[model samples]
Target chain A: MSAFDIYIKSINDVLEELKNSGRRINVFNVPSSCSELPRTIPVNIGGNANPGIILRQDTYVELGNPEAGSSAIMISTNETGLINDGRITLIGPDIPESADKSLPFGQVILIGGASLDDKEHETLQQPGFVGDKIEGYMIRSLPQNIWSRISKDGAAKGFNFECLGKALIYLYKSENPKIESMEIIFITSAKDDVKLLDNISEQVRKISKEITKENWKIKGYDIDCELDCSSCGDKSVCDDIRDVLKSRKKKGLVK
Target chain B: MINIYSQLMSAANKSLFGLTLGPQNESDGPFIMGNGDFFIEIPVAFGCSFSDLTLTGAMGTGLPNAAELIDKGTEVGVESRLCNAIKVATYYLEAGLLKTPDMIITTNSCCDAMDTLGNLLNGYKPWAHIPRFNMHAPHSYDDASYEYMGKQLRQAVKFMEDVTGRKMDMDRLREVCIESNKQCQLLLEFQELKKAKPCPAEPDLAREGAEFKNWSKDRISPQVTEWLEILVKETEKQVKEKKGIEGVDEKIRFLWQDLAGSWASGTVLARLQKELGAVCVMDYVSFGTWTPVDLSSEEAMFTSFGKRFLLEDPMNRQALHTTDLFCNDILQIVKDFSCDAVILPAHIAHRDTNSRIKVVRDMCHEKGIPCLVLGIDIWDKRYMTPDVAFDRMKTFFEISGLL
Candidate 1:
C-alpha cells in the first residue's frame, strides 16, 4: 500500500524537496525495535525530571524556539516502503556543530504500519513528541510548534543527533509497538525550511482537528449546547465561555 | 492517566447526579444551591428529588446564554457590579428557566450575593406563595450563635414537615450524618495525597468541591464516599508510581487563593506549565479542612452543622470573619503544600477578600513566598480574560526570578 490516510501529500515529495534544497542531510539507520537502540535515554513521562530548570544559562542550544522559528508535525501512513524503518535524517547542522546558538528547527516524523488508522493520529502524536521525556532535553509548551533546549550537561555527555534520534526511536517503538517503519527528519537549516514543513503539516492538522473532537466524543465531551453560535448574536462572548467550559467538561468537571 | 482532581470531581458529580431522582427513592422535589453546599441534605434525607438548576442553568458558564442571562438580570434590577453567578441566577429564576420547587430552604453563611438572592427569591412575586424558611447566619461564632443557627435548622425541618406533610425519619438523617462523616474522612485522605512531591494531581482539580464544604456535607452519598475512596486509591497509585502532571517539569509550585479560583479551563496553568514548568500545587479548594461532625445526639447534629456552617464555609472563614483566618489559611497552605508562590485572584464581587489582599500578600511575601494579586473574577472571565491573567503571571514570574 503506497497511499494511506493522514498523509494528504505524497511522501515522495518530501524526499525530493529535501534532496533538491541544497542543505546537508545525513541519514543514520538503527535497529527496527526499541530494545536494539543504545540505552542512552529512557522514556521519562510526567515531565522533565528537573522542570522549568536547566535555566537559559545552562542550555547550550535552543532549537525551533518561538523567537527564531518553530515548526513540527507527526504524519503517518500505512503504505509499505514509504517509511524506512529506524532511519533518522538530519537536514541541518547537528548539536556539537551548532552550539551556543538558537536555530529555526523543523521536525517531521513519518510512521507506517498496516494497522494504523486516521483516528489514532493524536495517539500517535502523543509519544512522538518527546518533551521532557528525554533527559536534559526540555521542551517549552505544546508541541504543535516545537521549542526545546539541550542542557550543557546533556551536550557534554555526548547527547548528539545519534543519541537524540535513538531516544526518539526508543520512545516511539516502545510506546507504539504496531509501528513497523519509522523515519524522522530534523531541519535546522533556515526559518524558511521550517515554514516549508509547517505548510505540509497544516494539511494533516486539518484532519487532526476533526479526529481530536472525535477523541473528545469518545471521552464523553461534546459542545453541550443546542444553539449554533454561527447564527447567534452573542456568539463572540459565548465563544469564550464555550471553549473554556468544553475543556472543563473534557476533564469531567461539574456544571 | 486522568489527574486526581478530574477523577474525584467526576466521581463526586456522577455519584450524586440524579441521586434524589433515582428509582430507589421517592420525590419531595426541593430546589437548592449546588455550590458544594449541604442544605440539599434536608430534602435529600427526606427522599426529595433535588431539581436545583442553579449550576445547571446560569452558573454553568458553558450555557450559550450565560452572559445574556446575566445582562438580562442587570436590565431587570440587579446591579451591574454584582457577581455574574448571582446575576444570571436571578435572571433565570425570574425567567422561570429553572423548575419551581414546592419548598425553598435558603441558607446565608456564604456571601451577600447569596443572602440578597435568597431575600429576593423569598419575597419574589412569583415565588412569594411558595413556603420558604431562612437560616440567616449571624457573624458571631459562639455557642449562642451556633444555637441560633441550629435552632433555625430545626425550625427549617419543622417548616419542611409542615410543607411536605411528611414526618422526618430520624434514622435516615442519622445514617446520612454517618455517611457524611465517611466522606470527610475520605476527603482528608485524598487531600493528604496532594502534599506529595511533584504534586501527583492537576491544579484546577484541587479548586473544586466547594459544594461539599459545609451544611451541604450531609448530602454526601455512598457513591460520593466510594468515589472519594476510588480517588484516594487513584492518587495513592500515582504517588507510588512517582507520577505528576504530564509534561510538567514542576520547577515552581504555587498555591491559588482565588474565591472561585481560575476557571480558565486550565489555559492559565497550562501556559505556565508549558513555558516555565510551573505548577499550581493547591488552591483554596485543595483541602477538605473540616473535621467529622458529632452524631451522638440529635442536638449535636444541628450544632455541628452550625460549626461547619460558620467555621468551615469559605465566606464565613475568610470573607465575613476576621482577616486573621484569611491570612492564616493562606500562609498555612503555602507551607503545607510546599509552594514557591501564591496567586490570590481578586474577584470583583469579593470585596471582603479583596480588602484583605494586602494583608495576605504582605504576610506571604514576609515569609519569602511570592504572592501575586490579580484583578479578575474567577467565575466570570469577562472581567479579566485568561490571556490577560496569564500574561500578568508570566510577568510576575519573571520579576520574581521564577522564570
Candidate 2:
C-alpha cells in the first residue's frame, strides 16, 4: 500500500455511508481502458486559449458556480490498489437532467499509480490536463477550484457526468503515461455535500499546495504575500502623494 | 518596501520632464531621457533629468482629459498611429501646456516616431527661432564611433553655452560626472537587490526605479544621489530583513521587456499579483548594467558619454540598437533575475521591437522560458484594454503551466 491508500479508503468509506443513507448514487465504468483513452485538446482553445467564457444565454448548466457555491477535491496517490481503473460515480441529477439550474458542485478526482510522485502532481492536475482535453467543458478558475460551464451545444451532443467522467479519464490517462488507475466523483446533490467535500479536501489541498511550493522553490521562488496586497500594491505613492492618500484614507477613500 | 522609496519616486517625478509640465515658468532644467555624461552638458541637464517612461506615460494618459488631448494632437495634422505619449507631448507644445524652451536638443534615441515628432517640436511656430540643435547618434558602436559622437557632444556644449552665454565649466562638469558615477553604482546595487529570492521589491518598484534613474541626471545637486543612497540603503535593509512588497507573494517572476514606454493603466502587475502570485521582477527601464565613465579627463568624459548614449542608455541601448542587443538584454535579465517568463509588451509603435519579437520568442523557447508577445500600444489603453491584457496573461500563465 502506498501513502494514498488511507485517503482512497476514507473517500470510499464516505461514499459508501452516503450510499447506504439513500443518496442517489450511480456508478459507471469507462467504456475504454486507460491505454486506449482518446487524447484531445479542446478545439475551442487551440493551445492559445482566451479566457473561456460561456455566456449566460449560451449556457446549458453551470457547475460549482461561484454564486451557487463551489468546492473541489483533488488527490493523487501511488497506491494503484483499491483503485477502480475506469469508474465514475455521480451523485444527484446528471448534467443533462438539469436544464438551467445552478448546482452546489463537488468534484473529486483520485489518481493512483505505482510510479506517481509529488513532482508530477502539478502537471497531472494542470487545467489543460482536465479542461483542455474535455471537449464541452470550460473551466473558469485556477487549479484546485472549479467554476465551470457546460455549453448547450455540448448537452445537445449528449454531454453528462458519465461522458464528462469518461472525457476526463481519457484526458488524464492519455496525457500522463505513469497513471495506472483513476476515479472521479461528482456531487451536485446538496450544499451540505459540497461543504463536506470541502471539509474532506483540507488534507489534499495542503498536499497540492506543498507540491506547488516545492516546484517553485527549485526555481528559487518564495510565495510572498497572502493578504489583499493588490489594493495596497498600486496605491504605493509617497511624499505628498502618500500624505494625500493618508488624508483620503481617514476620510474613507478606500476600504 | 523602503521608507525613503516614495521620496526617491517624488524626486524622480520632478525631473526635467516635469520642470515644464505645470504652470512653472521659472524652472531652468530642460533635460529629457537621453544624454549620458554629455547629458548635463546640454544646458538643460543643469539640474534634473527624468527616466521611467512608465511614470511619464501613466501621467500623460491618465490625465482625465488625455483622450481629448490626443484628439487635439490629431487635430493639428499629427497622425494618431504615432505613439500616444509622443502625440500628447506634441499637443502640449501646440496648446502652450509646455512653455517654449530657449533651446531644445532633439536626439532620436527612440525610433522613427521621433523623426516626425522632432520636426514638429523643432519647427513649432513659437520655438522655431530658438537655437535648436539636433544631436546626431551613430548606428554602430566602436572606438571611432564613440569619438564620432563625442565630437558632436562638444558641439552641443558649445551650441548651448554660446546661446545661454554661460561658459562651459570643465572642473564642475568633471565633479558632476564623478557624482553621476556614484549614483549609477548605487543603482547597479539596487538592481542586484531585486534578484533576491521572494523578490524583496515588488513589480512597481522596478517601474518607480526607472524614473529614479533620470533623477540622477541632476548632476549639480547631490540630493538625487542622496535619494539614490537612501534607495539602496532601504532596499538593502529590505533584503537583509527578507522583506518583499507588502502584499506580493511572488509565485512567478517575469521579466517585462519593453515595459519602458508606458504603464498599461498600471493593471497588469497588480492583477497578475492578485490572481497568481506572479510579480514582475524586472523590466527594461529598471535593468541598467553599464560600464562607468573613466572620469579622468574632460575629453574622455565626452567619449564615455557618447558610448553610454548609444550603448548604455535605457531605451536607446536595446530599442535603437541591433536585434542581438534586444535578445541578449531579455535573456540576460531572465537569467540574472531567475525569471520564469518574459512579457514583451509589443506596443504597436515599436516597429523595431515588434519586427524582432519572433526571434526573441524563439530564443526564449530555446532557453525553456515562456515569452508572451502582447500586441498593444503601451502608451494608449484604447488599442487593447487592460481587461484583454489580463485575459491573455492569465491564459498564458495557465497554458504555460506557470499557474
Candidate 3:
C-alpha cells in the first residue's frame, strides 16, 4: 500500500481498537458547495502553477447551479453510534462548470467504530491522508470550509463529483474496515440551500474544535487561548492554570 | 503656509503615484520595499525609492470604499484579532490595490502578526517571484546582536545593489545619517521645550516631527528646521509671557503613552484642550530617542543604523525592553512634562505594544502614577468610534480628579 493508504489504514486500526473497547461511536456528515468557497479561499488568489485541482477549467461537465455560493465539509465521529445521520444528497452544478467560477465545494466524512476509553480517544481520530490520493485537486482548509481547485486539464479530462466521491468512499472503506457504515452528501445549489449547509458545517466545526480541545486537555496539553494575555481581564485564572500545569510537571505526572 | 502645504501635497501625490502607477513602468528603477519602520538611510544610499507597504496599504488615499478594502482581509480568513493595520495591508495586496514590489526586505522583530503578514506578502503574486531578504532583530541589545544586525544591514545593502543595479555610496549614506541626526537633535530640543509650564506647541507639531522623521531622507530642509526654530522661539516667548496654550488653563498635562494617542484627530485634541483641562504634551511616536550617528566613520554609521534598528525602532525592541522603556519614559516625563497622569491608548492594531500594557500599568501603579489604559483602534476608527474614546477619556479624567 502507498504511504497515503497506509496512514488511512493506521487511523482505521485505532478506530477498530477503540470499537473493541465497548465505546459507542457516532458520526455526522454534512455536504455543501462553492458559494462558501470564496469566503474561505485566500484573498490573494491568482494563477498557481502547483499541482492541485483548479475549479476554473475550460470544460463542459454540467456544473449544476451557478448560484451555489456556499460550501462546507464537516466530519465528526464519537463513541456513540446512536447519533449517526446517513442522509446523502447530491445536487447542483456539474464538476467542470463548478470548477470555472472558482466556487466553493465541500465534502464531509463521518466515521464511528466502537467506544474506547479516554486514553484511546486521541488514537481514534487520526489525521486523514485522502487529500493527496486525489490527483490534481488542491485543498485549502478553513474552519468550516474546505476550498479546493481542479487543474485546467484535470477538468477537461472529466474529473467530476462522482469520481471524486467514489474515490473518497473507496479510500475510507479500504483504510478503515472497522467503520461499519459511511454516508456521503454533495450539495451544488444556490443561496438558501448553501446557507443551510453552512449553518450545519459551522456547528460541526465548533463541536469538532471543542472535542479536540478537550482531548488535548485530558492529555495534559495547554489549551489554546484566543485572546492576547495582555489585554485579557482574566489573567489571574490563566496564571492559576499555568501554575497548576507547572506543578503537575514538577510531580512527573506529565511528559 | 500655502507653499508648505503645496509642497507636502506634491510629495504625497508623487508617492501615491509611485505606489500605484509607477510600478507598471518596467523600465523604471526596481522597487525596494519594506515595512514602515525600516531604516531609510540604506534605501537612500542606493538611490532607490523606498516603498513602505504598510503605509501605502493602510493610508493610501482615493479609495472608493475603505470599508470594503478592509473587509477584503476578513473574507480571506484573516482573524479579526490580528492587527487591523496588517489586515488592511494584506487586503491591499490581495485586492491588487497595491502593486507588487520588485524585491522585499523585512525584519522579524515587529510582532507575530507582522511576521505572518510578511510571509503572506512574500508568497503572494508579483512579489512571489522576487528576492526577499529577511533580518531578525534580536530580543536583547548586546555586542553579539550588534554585530549580527550590522552584518545584516551590510547584506541588505548588497541585496539592494544586486536587485536594483545600483551601487551604494558610503558618502551619501553618511550625509543622510548626519542630516537624520540634525533632525533628531531638533526633535529632542523641541521635546525639552514641551516641558515648559504653559506648553507652547500642540499635538500637531508633534505629529509634524513624527512625519518628518518617518519620511524625510535628505538633510533636514531649511523649511523644517526653520519651522522648529520658530516653534521654539514662540514657545520661549510664551514662557516669558507666562501663558499656557492660548486660552486654555492647562489644568492637567498628560504624556500620551506610545503611538496610540498619536492618531487622534485635531478636533479631538481641540476638544480635549477646550473641554477637559487635559493637554497631551508628549506621545510615543514624537518622543522616540534619536541616537546620533558618527559621520566620520562609515563603520560607525552602519553600526549606528543597526543599533537603531534593533534597539530604537519601537516595533523592533524586545518585549521586556519595550515595557521597560515605556515605564521609564512615563516616570521621567511625569516629572519633566509636569504631568498629572499618563493615558495609555492601548491601540488594538499594535499587538506587541498592547501585550505589555498590564506590566506597564502595574509598574505605573507601583510608581504612584495613574495610568489609564483605554482600549482603542489607532487606524480603523470604525472599530472604536471617536465619541466612545472621548467618553472613556472623560471618565478617566473624572476618576483621576484631573477634571
Winning model by DockQ:
3
Top candidate when judged by lDDT against the true structure: 2
Residue pairs with clashing backbones, model 2: A224-B249, A225-B248, A225-B249
lDDT per residue for candidate 3 within B1-403, as digits (tens), equals: 3434234434534534444334532225566666555787676555556666666555532244656766776777787777666677777777777655678898775566677777777778666778898876676554457667787888888888887677888887877676666666566556655766667656446555545555543224455565555555565565556666665777878877756432364445567877876888877656555556645466656777777777766545433243433444566567546678888877776666666666667657865777888877666667777777788888888888777
Every model's DockQ, to 2 decimals? 0.01, 0.01, 0.01
Task: Report the C-alpha displacement of residue B38, candidate 1, in angstroms.
Answer: 4.6
Residue B13 in model 1: lDDT: 47
Interface RMSD for each predicted structure: 20.8, 22.0, 24.5
| Per-model C-alpha RMSD | 25.9, 25.5, 28.2
What is the per-candidate TM-score for chain B? Answer: 0.88, 0.89, 0.86
Residues A110-212 of candidate 1: C-alpha lDDT, one tens digit per residue: 7877887755556666422454467777655322457677888778877776677777777677777777788787888887777776556766665565565
Docking class of 1: incorrect
Clash count for each candidate, listed in order shown: 8, 3, 36
Q: What does candidate 2's lDDT look like per residue over B69-130, in tens digits?
A: 66776787777677777676666667766544556666655567666666776677876577
